[model samples]
Target: MSNSTHISTLIKERTGLDVGTQFRADLETILHDLAKGDLEQYLADLRATNENAPPWQTLMRALTISETYFFRDSAPFQLLRQPILPNIILERRHHKRLELNVWSAGCSTGEEAYSLAILLYELLPDLDSWTIRLKASDINNHAVQIARQGIYREWAFRHTNNGFQTRYFDPAPGGWQIKPHIQRMVSFSQNNLLNEVPRPQFDLVFCRNVLLYIANDFTKAIETLIFDSLIPGGWLIMGQSEAIRWQRERWTTHVFADATLYQKPLPHQIMTPPSRYPIASIPAMPDYELALDALYNERSSEAEQILKGILAEKPGHAPTHILLAYILGSRHALSSAHRHLDDALNSDGMLADAHYLRATLFLEEGKDVESREALRAALYCQRDHPLAALMLGNLYASIGDMAKASRTWESARQAVIGLPPETRVSVLSDMTAAGFDALVKGQLGIANK
Candidate 1:
């Protein structure tokens, strides 16, 4: 029962978004950084402005970390390719209309929405005959604009293995531009998830890796909205880390491999957890563990060999890909590392460790912006991420934003304090809550109370 502050209420009123305790540091950082410590004056200016959108949107933009690559998480895509798409297609076949409506809520730059379209094209033999609509929305207008453009850098294709780049993208002056048909498939709009999602009753909805940043009440409200947006039997997939505690009576939890899914069950459908998938698709037990051991001990080559061996057996084993990325990163094989990171996330976007590793890699390479995004993604995936908040706070310090940095450090301290003794986060950084507090107090001139 956390009470919302005035600033939090303002944000909630404007966008139906909550700046919860978890995001307090983030909000404070943005406000303090923008205002240069005179937050009250900034607030007054914001209040006086007729164009309320700018101030609010600026804060929102800073708060959002758009750290997405195309097909960064592949489990849901697998479900789509295997059964979801086929089932949806079959369900609508009786009407003689191959109609599909899909929504990618919080779609950063249209990669996910386009990925769905590509899957649809690949699966259906007669795609042209079908009435297809892939609608994508983001609260960030800049991201929405970028999504509409359909042009992206090489980095965006890191997780992409389907040769979609070869078939669907043309080399542009700056980067790769998606072709007309793929572009035509997805429609991007700037919309906040909390308030309005115009198109309802989607066959499949993707709101992956997006909800955990919001407050609990808003998250439930958003979930309710998603439930309402679905066709009776439509499936809703979230990020790997996000496990919905929705009332079992309304939805059936479907476990597929390491992925858990919720399907909007139709009338008279049982509300029990779906049985374990009978397919022998899970990675062989010892190899992944062995690979992890090799990775932690600095056996880069050995780890790569082990991971590659496992990958040959189970190409979709995302953890292997992530480990391989870490190994390659140590070797300064940055491009290769990006591919592995993308593939790992593509395989399972819920891997907070992978995002943490990506942040570490980015920091090593002196890519602070990329590291920030990676850290944010890691926190979003797993709030109790190891050293993520600390590193991000250090990153702000490096950028000379002491106010933001100090606030972030405080947040990290609070997070650590709340952790159970047994489940405490461990990182090689060897930094503790006491150490962080001392550093922040000394550097940022905070008074000891």
Candidate 2:
């Protein structure tokens, strides 16, 4: 085999890393740095079957970037503080089992794992009786060692409250030392994700910012392993930039205002956890026409107020929830829109229009996984949803599934034609029939009528 191929094989064999398709240039840089001037000698040494390979950890460390700080990105931590931890508390409360197990796969220097422990401490009450296993691991032993020390410089506290430093850490010589209670919550280890078996039934797993470093194939492998490791209804969080968009079958893209979390769906569960405030009495639900008329006439303020009144009264009314979500979505009130959508689905999981509207919201936000679930849910509820079919076709095209897109658009075309001439569909905005006509012609290669 060529030296480069052999080196790649060695990387995978020794480090469980695939280096990925964009590695050649990076490999050259690494080789140049390793050689300093003697490329030939370096290649020879790398290829040698001496069974005495130089400590691969140095190369692993050189290739991987480990820059991290407490609550880096902060969104997932915010999510933990809200619905995620609280719901877990509720689920286990009745059983008198307050058990929370968490893992940070690419712990780096333990910022993320500690941050999770802090969130648990801050958000939940009576945690003193809970069983908590917060484990953190990095491939780099040096990083693990530093993390075990539980000391941090000021830079790590940039995004964190100084109160956390005061409350959870004690001032020490080199830097502030993590308080014993906080430090005791976490166990630090050096782990190769591919080689190590993840502890199962974890309440949540933070595998963020780690998958992108591995090869595309290995990333998939790691994702599957994570999927298997999570208990039903457990949460998996990735880096904000990562794509859970394509992982619909394995995870529910639980889109929040600040973060998108992947949830291992509970078996036989339909929607997310039920709304805390379910309506007690059935109020007279209003027709969507008033809101639609106001919205279509550019009277969004009038429409929003009407929706607010209706929802405030009959929060249990699924159709009203869907319409409000639709109106709020058009106005780009995404956080509120998602809230209404979640409630609508919870009230009635088979609401096709609500699902379609949700799909469009995710699409506008550039979230594929989030969009995919809603689209699929829309189709699942009512397969002939023309707009959803069209958007699903668009989504298929986006992921380079042209053949599927072609077939899907063909179906979407028929669905569109089957609609009454006056039947209107709204995406980011209301799309005219003529617009849908041209959409298929341009996207599906249909000849002009």
Candidate 3:
């Protein structure tokens, strides 16, 4: 068998992962770049080496893309505001000290971490009187560094609004910086969620969007770890897409008007069977859907008015800020757009669309320098982000830097190749029409002389 085939078979046998031809090609590309040895030789060497390696930390890091942002999945935050916080407060009201502890596992770059801090500040009027502990941890060192800085570009907040900008951040040298009080509310550290030693238990744990990357076994294990890490009767929050059936058996499920929350079962409370029906069967808010449609159709003024009306009715609606930022950007209201973006990012930093949109806006405004930075930020937040690379390459081309443009296009090409076949065709066609062919053939290695 060929070396690539051998490697693919081994990977499938061991990991039970059936990657597509595109991903297999990408894996070969990665191996070629490494050039330590051929696949079989490398696998043989790995077997001959230590009986135990550091639990494949490097592989885990590569496989797991910890992309997050402020106030991701508004439903969880809604539940936090409506039911979770109120329940905790009521339960602990008689205690001599009222305290709340929150942990954001796999926090990425502190967007979710800071979002929680902001939520606490906004939710609790007498926050000073309550003992609040918010801890965020991630396994990625680079992400940890960025989290500690607490500085982000205008692009990062593309889904925020003017009011949120005025309230939360101070304009810094290059971008916006989180306020000192906001900064102090959360502490960050490097932590592997797979750590053997038990960490302090939390009252609320937000481990969103991280489980999707791991194998099913690993997912269950991590969910169990989260369960163990929470205090009895504590809330365990997950991303909108993630759920735990076994954990649900051990916990009581609470359904808010818009979202679902899980709580550890109290002494007298018996866990109820989850409803057989899907959540999607529930009707969506017509006004919100109409607003989104208007925004998507590029009617910025109309969308802005709709979103503002939605906000007036539901002030805590986080998604409105993001939509407002998009509208503001479309209107060339960069400053106002940034305000809304910041608010949206502050709430949930993982909105990749917002980051992508903001970068495009920066490019349009002739801020090439800032646009480059924004493009990089967008890619860091979303590795497979095509718009970021496309814009970045176009920027380089406009500046007559063919080499950089070629490299950016090559990266874009590589990214798109891993996508669905239809998506690949569309992206490649777009790139080609944008004069990517000359650059790719000229500087990138893909084309022959």
Candidate 4:
């Protein structure tokens, strides 16, 4: 096997992480950087020790994503605030028990864990009479240490805008410190999900955005671990981009207005097909969809032809104009793209997509200031425009305004977190909510580094 293959196999065997083709180059680069001048010796040494060794820890840190914020995604938290926790509380209250056990699996740096504690604190009026075991754990020991500190900079509070910082945290040296009362609600520890040890009976388990990094072969095992760890009729929440598709029948799926949740069924409970979002009655422009599909499939010429035909029939069609502008931009025809975008804006002055497309064109022409202004216009039209926020954050980062950049990227993330992963965003192209989120995550990761 090649060195890359050997390293991939080693990583999988040790960490249950698949360094797939998308990240194989990154793995090789890490290997070269760590190996220095002697690759053979480094590989042999890595194979000689257990995964918990310093070398393995360094590798895991490089591979795993530790970028997270409090209330990272609003949708899941809303679901928890609603039927999930309330239902659990009702069940417990019937038995005269006011205890809650919530686990934050792969809880990097404790933001999510603390968010859970805060939620429980807010929801429970008779908090003094309740036993809340909000356990949080991660495979990275370094992250666990940071979590134990309970101090965070401004970047960690990007998602918290409802005066949570003032209510639950106090100003401390280096950053804000989570209040002692909230800190005492959670216990942080280092844990690997692949471990087969006995797990706690958690009322709710949040393993969001963690399984995306795991090998395909190992995701089922980890899912099973989570399933076994939850009590019957308990809830499991995943990230917007993640889901329990395989072996989904084992858990009862609940489709909420904002997010989808899974529950472990009680004994003899009937299993029903997962409910889907109701399709809107309004029909979309079929030709516009055809053009979008053609563009997405890389048949640009065909898409352009279809878009032109649509414009010939309906000159005021802003969506077709936007799609044509996208095609022109992709082909490096900036002037043509701008003309089409102008037409789009003329048809509908409040079109956020047109403004965002204008920003992209400005950025490609090296007009950073113009691009920034265009992005601001887009955001003004629609405050939660993900792509506009993403581009604006990039511009901020490029100019050394990292604090502003983090806030902007967090806004981008928040905008898309409530939507279904497959929900289409950007009329300019075929970007999905999941795709936009990945871009935001990449930006945040670079900022964190």
Candidate 5:
């Protein structure tokens, strides 16, 4: 076998990590750095060392980015802080058993696991009575060591508030140290999800952002492992982009405002967790709201699914079509996205977001004429649409129309300035008013130059 193919196969066999084209460059760099440009020697060394050895650990560090922070997404944590954990607490209380088990799989640097411990502390007032097992594991040994240390720099606390920092962390040399009590709640270990056994004990399994990196061949195996690890009625929270695609009907899908979770249903037992936007409240409003919530949380797949279902029932649903188009556009299915946008505009030509998204798709494909028309339509529909205005201004500037670009950008700035900085431009968008303002201001400065 060629050295490249052999190395990739060896990595798959040893680590179950995908050495796909995206990672080929990184693999070559690792070989050069570790083996002094000798591919055969690196292969020999890799084969000789077991997973727990220093060589394997160093390889893992290079392969995995370990880019994470405390309460990284905030949505799953919100779901846990509410109905999930509270419901578990009630059921356990009824059985006169105060015990909780949680697994944070692929917990890079321990931020997520520590976040869970802090959430539990806040939720359970009588915490001393409960027996908690928060097991956090990652394949990277270096990360595990850092997790055990429980110290993190300020960068890790970007999403965290000052009050939380003061309450749970003490200022230490070079960084902040997690309080002893919170540290005691968690146990860290080096673990590969591929090697995970079915324990059937955890009340919650958080395997977020881990499946995206696993080899496609091993993804199902890891998924099965995660499913088996959770007790009946236990919840599994994965990343926004990932979901249980295989045997999906076996698990109950819980659509929440901030997150979508899969629950292993109990045998012959129906589970209904309370929701702020309950599905039973109104006929179609709940599903639409759920879709909006999914979009807000960056759960594009979930939003797309719900929006499609809505479209199946009500084909003329302009809003649903617009949302589905946005999701499709994100996936680069431009033609499909354009069709959806056309359907939305047909239903309601006044839909500014639909026009804006269509403009974006057109711009992506380099159809400047069509894109400019769409942008104008969007601005006409909603005069204060910052995104449409910004894009239109940038389009003008690209053609060296500095005067028009500057005037359009000034309008864009005014449109964005009225909204709260933290307010999202739309439920279907991740950009906030503050971000839009920054973009316009940056463009204006460049235009003047």
Candidate 6:
């Protein structure tokens, strides 16, 4: 039998999981690497050395998504603040007692859950008065433990400002540790969104940036579960790229200034079927490259106009809102910038740039506390966001935490190393040789000592 056939048969026999026909390319690569005598030898050695090998969990950790950061997207939280959240609060207040329940399904390492907590505390002062509940669950047990600890590296605070960092986190051995109060707001558990029963009703369900990996049937099932998990008239928030593909009549689409959000049917509200004909062919929005170039060329106003135009056509375009938020913030229109930031978050729960921009805006507005929180969110979305790291380091330095600041700057430098050579050179040049040298020497001295 051919290697392809043999490998397929072996995988099917040894692991019930199907490596589909579409994954032939991936299989070929895996076989090529194995043929180099590394993987096969390692497996043979393992089988010979140990009577029982490590569980599939150990193997899966290597394969599953580890590309998560704090606050991964700023736009969804903006939506949460401006409309989805406030509306839920207003509607829920009429109940016997005001209560808000939020679930971060597939909440990798608690960053998303913690981001929600920070937002709630920063935005809503009367949080203690309200019966607020937030839960974060993931299939990965290791991630659950990390999330519960609420400790993260300086890279995790890239987009954060100095003031917020001073207020919320304390220096730990290797990184910053979240305050107990913030950690207390979220309960982390190990539960699979795909196979397990979802915890009871929630006012808002954040299942962002995860569905793209699941099969279509599984996605529909998950969505159905989410729909069932919400209280009447609650909200279902998804990633920017994700649409309500399965259920047309069950939820009403709420097009906000930021991103598209879905509202559940009210108890007495009738489910209206979507028109078979196109209501209107909303032209697909232009790509972010145009906006980025406009911003790069210092034409902030023109970039803002292009972004707004795109948003006008497709309100759910997360990238446009994210770029617009950055442009508006750069122009110092704090309110307008924040509005666009919120729209970006609402539209795409995974756009990291929105969080970074919002952090900058919060800092500019002298809202240090809010800025730090926003920075944390940005870092959580993209751990390698250099600007976020530089700003965070500067914030720490301002607070007289030179050690933390140095560590953060060093991390930023390392992140830049992984970028294109030209980009890396530009970033290093911007840091100036003296600043970069001092940071490197400081780290080296510490290591040696």
Instruction: Choose the strongest candidate by TM-score.
Output: 5
What tens-digit string does per-residue lDDT give for candidate 5 at 251-363?
Answer: 88877544678888787544443322110101124577688788777787998898888778766566677778888998999999999989877644556778889999999
Task: Write one digit per residue (lDDT tens) for candidate 1, span 274-383.
Answer: 43221111122356557666766767678789889977966655656766876787788988988888887775575666787899888888888999999998766545
Off by over 4 Å in 6: 1-54, 159-162, 198-200, 272-449
Q: Ten residues in a row with the worst lDDT in model 4?
A: 275-284
Candidate 2 local Cα displacement, residue 262, angstroms: 0.8
Report how far residue 316 has shifted in candidate 3, in Å: 11
The 10-residue segment with the lowest total lDDT in model 1:
275-284
Kindly give the number of clashing pairs for every candidate.
4, 1, 23, 0, 0, 17
Between candidates 2 and 4, the one scoring higher on lDDT is 4
What is the C-alpha local distance difference test score of candidate 4?
Answer: 0.79
Model 4 clash tally?
0
Q: Write the per-residue lDDT of candidate 2 for residues 1-449, one digit (tens) a residue.
A: 65556666766665556663547667866756766766666666765632224444566566666888898987677446433565576557656677888989889988888888877765443457778989898888778888999899999899875366897899999898998888888999887787767556787989988876676656766787788888887888999888663456656775554567877877865355421211011111123456667878889788778777766754545656767787788789998888988987764455567788898889889889889888987766555566777888888888888888887788777666634455454422476656776777688873211
RMSD of each: 18.8, 14.6, 20.1, 20.5, 18.8, 21.5
Q: What tens-digit string does per-residue lDDT give for candidate 4 at 246-345?
A: 7988888867545678888776654655432221111124576577788888898999999899778766566678778888998899999999999978
lDDT (0-100) at residue 115 of candidate 5?
93
Task: State the lDDT of candidate 6 residue by residue for 291-343, as single tens digits.
Answer: 65676777767777777776676554655666666666666888987887787
- The pairs that clash in candidate 5 are none
* lDDT score at residue 433, model 2, on the 0-100 scale: 57
**lDDT of the structure predicted as candidate 3:** 0.63
* Model 6, CA-based lDDT: 0.63
- Could you tell me the TM-score of candidate 4? 0.60
List per-prediction Cα lDDT, in the order shown.
0.70, 0.71, 0.63, 0.79, 0.79, 0.63
